[model samples]
Target: MIQASISAVPGLIVSFLILAALVAAPTALVAKARSKPWPLRTALAVYLVGIAAVTLLPGDAGLESWQCDTGMPTRLFTSVSSLLNIALFAPGALLAVFLFRRPVTVAAAFGALSGALELAQSAGHLGRSCSVTDLAANATGALLGSSAGALWIYLRRQSPGKPLRDLAWGMSLGALAVLAVGGVFESRIDRVDIVARDDQKRALAETAVQADEWITAAARGVFGSDTQVRQTATATASVTEPDEGGCRLRITATTNHGTISGSWPAKTLESARSSDVRADEGSLGAREVAAAAARLAREWFPQHAAGSVQRVRPVGHGPTTVYRVTYRRYAHGVLMPMRLDLTLTGTGRVLGFAAETVADPVLPPVTVDEAEAKALAQGAAGAPGEFRRALLLARQVRGVWRPVWLVGDGSGGRASGRDVAVDAVTGERIAGEISGAATPTAATGGPPSSR
Candidate 1:
């Protein structure tokens, strides 16, 4: 939640300038009409605008709508950020109540404001995420703030807050109603789930053995010959019916000194499974678990799997405490482009590992280099190209994986920009574009068959 708040600052800064310009207008009118102090009104206006800025502009506007990429919050505590969100907006709602002396009017205005903000976010206006949870959090804050302000005015032997006691009930009812409607929509959204079976042996014994050997050999290369290595335990793999994303093979296994696991589902490493893997309690904390996962990943595939741990957060999400670590993958020994995610339950128990591994990218040839490709894309679009990247990969196209030089341009396919696939052999361009941000859940799209 704190991480999310910090990210909102960039957009909030922009809105603040806008808010600053209009602050005087609101302050003059409110202070004069309500017989309030100038300093107090100015301060209140500033506070409300700041709240509006944060509430409206949360984070990057990925070229996708409803980027619930963080995955749904299963537990109640997952939404403590909602509480902070409420606090941020409360002051403004309270000020509105004081100025209007009407709880109903203030609450209605907040509802409309929240709705507009949500729409703007969805439409990719200010580079912020559109969240249903945020709307609820803002509404909850506004209702409470309005009620409190009205109550304060009433206690002062005034008629301002008299309607609030009854209005509070209406506010609660309205919130529940909105949640119910949103809940219906959310429930209708499809999800990818797995059914698991514990195996005394991995899916293919020889393949698993090869993967194990890959890890051990890489471990020796990475950690030296004297490093303590782990032996693989029989893994638990799930076979789920193919969804829109295609059939995903997920498995979790514990190793001798650590753990080894992987999933072939999402482009991001953290989103392999919806459930949590429990580890032995009172054991390894966050850093230890991350180290073990990193070591295992390095050993699993030294060249491609090399990465630096980016972010680590301890979440009380499942039965056992889990450490979710994001590792930025190194491509051609350079940082960025790819990412690996590792989640370890308590005591070094590996929960899951995910990555988009272009196992064998045959770089045919490059007729169009980076600069030329950028110019080509810009000329084709007749607009300024913001981003350009060239990488060789066996892009699965038409149920076949063919080598291509993926050239990304900021043409905003999803509005975040997408990569154009250039034929490595023919030097011709493909029709589609790969998105810049990691895809959250897979949906209907003509894709090469999933491997």
Candidate 2:
């Protein structure tokens, strides 16, 4: 939730700015727009049209995850939020139409324009999506605004010619328009999310081995007139005996782009399938690794007999625990030996893992170095040198300072750092105890080191 909140701050700021403009610009366009009697009907009509326009625009406006792309049902959280927003405005729009009597044409025009603007913002090309759903919601909001205006008029019972009534109506219509516009830019209207910089390295590292294997296989395949991409890749990994940590399974996959491989060094057990083991002991169960290894071998070679796990052992520990496991792969009625170098969390969950073919197996344990540690940290931080200083500084103190990569002013470059903390490593700066100063202190910290 905290991560999500931090992620959403930029979107909120954008929304506020857009909303302000929407409210203010209309007042300038039609000076008397605020003065007229309530036009509830017109507002409602506009709201409907506006919503329709926002949803149907082309370009990459809609969310493109496997779920959304494959037409899976939306999650409950999304459905509830949409329904709530719509419910909030429905009654208001009806009342607005009943009391203000807005012209249908004006309402329709507003709706259409509003939807178009939202689409422009949502589609990445225009920094907006041509989102039909957004238009629908905005239209609903317009109706609500109109109804609110009508209620205000009915309660006031002012003379039809009074300047106050005209002002009230204008204000209501303008507010509705502003709200609709604000919601689009302010609340992350676009659902198409690309991976951010921080997570990219981790994702790449995790998938490198698979990519290599796939490329290698493709290349080895016979090329034909219809051949699209052609390649074979293979990597050897070491195995160890089972120990306290989860077994290690390292697979190095190579590809034309580059050779990338990951090792699952540790695993944490969130829940054990069997209660014979203490659930609190966070190491991955030997049986689980065996199961996964068997599944992989079977999936890889369905025509061959299933493989068996020979051994599992811990190699090291830190951000990710390291393990080495020896497993056998059976192919074409022959048993082929293989070793898995697995990287896992302390909790027994797999992180990065790989498997290598073993022949003449007497491979010695490889040395783990500071470079590897730094790389792990960098991956966790999303980029090198981003959280380095902060993490280094935090090492001095017992308390925690959160990591965040904020969008900096001016250049729009990302500035990554932690909240205020005692700088024990360099002793250059120390944070004094102060209540309610966490955010301010963090913000006032000097510019982050250039990455």
Candidate 3:
């Protein structure tokens, strides 16, 4: 998590400097007019600009609607990122106290500022998630900074500037103002409530042992045997409702170098990032990335490496290019449920890995042909388009995994394209969740033939 945060610092620094330059001259003039220390006021302005740059300006405006995260951390200071959030607002609060001469007022003002910024992050389409945990951390930092400022004033025998009655009035008004703003914005944002679950009815020791085994394997594969891997948290199990009959146990473990997380029993590597594979300073071509990823996939899954269809696509354009590689296996021209997906940087550093592991499912006979599936899809969609590709894959229907024909125009593959799944046995349209299994397309084959 710390490494992920560190990777973003360069962009944050550039944005902060640009915002600071725009505000510097006006900030200095205001400080001089107020007879306060110009340097301290300038610092305060720059610090606020840093906050804006970090939260509001850095990310792309891709969000379609406002979102609010109502989940709270299980514990405070849960990670390095949470600690950094606390530190982010402390300096601003400290500076405000010295400039405004009222510690309580400064803290309240900072609290309001944090709330307003969070609202902006959500409603302004900044592609940032607003969380209650962050708001709590920012408020805590403001209080701590204000307390330190109050202590300094006491030690110096300086007047605190406001009487008790006036201080109470100021705090009450600030609270009311904050409440008003929050009430206005609450109805506009969508609240996302996250619930944590553990449904694996097993002994704690057993779960820990299983998690340790997987974590050890992943760490050794990504880093080496010598790296010190530690279980960051207890493994948790959640019920998976797919046709695949097993619950998923998610294990998160951190090495001294990086973090690795995956599911148990299935023995799949969900994601792992280490400092071992440093990102390349320059961009790499798509072919280079695909070749590197293919090599790694072959090395990791030697048993299922042959006769798999590989697809490589580049995501995000910048100084670095991250490639998304997917390998889909097939049996006798029918797409298998098993799949391997990898996300790698231009330097071939593996940022993510997800492999779907499933035993060979007993498939029903294919009764509906590709042409029938296309006609059914055309009827369902109520519009006509050139249907070029038809692929055979498995989909879940009424709690059973069945062979289904995916017929589409070959636009975005099976996942996002104008595809329709028709149950091969019953010739009925499959309408719900596609399947837990990954779907393969006609990218590696010729025109569809009768099954």
lDDT of 2 by residue, 234-327 (tens): 2323444333232344443333322333343321111111112222335555566555544533543222223432445555544334444444
Best by lDDT: 3
CA lDDT for candidate 1:
0.53
Q: What ranking emerges by TM-score with the best candidate at the front?
A: 3, 1, 2
The lDDT values for all models are 0.53, 0.37, 0.70
After superposition, which runs of candidate 2 have C-alpha atoms over 4 Å from their true positions? Answer: 1-110, 119-133, 143-325, 335-338, 341-451
Candidate rank order under lDDT: 3, 1, 2
Tens-digit lDDT track of model 3 for 156-268: 88888775853886698678757865795676877764312212354445666867876777677765567688656655566564554555567778887678777666566
Candidate 3 wrong stretches, greater than 4 Å: 1-10, 33-36, 60-64, 194-451
Model 1, span 1-451: residue lDDT tens: 2246467556557678788768868777877888766765676678767765665555663325544223333322245676787776677888877766777767756765665565565545455655555666767778788888878877886786457654685567557656754563366423211111112133355455655555554334333454345444434345422333323434333333334345433211222332335455747776677677677666553544543434566778444788776654323322233456666677665555555443332333445555665555555455665644444444556545455555554333222345556655565667765332233211111122211
TM-score of each: 0.38, 0.25, 0.45
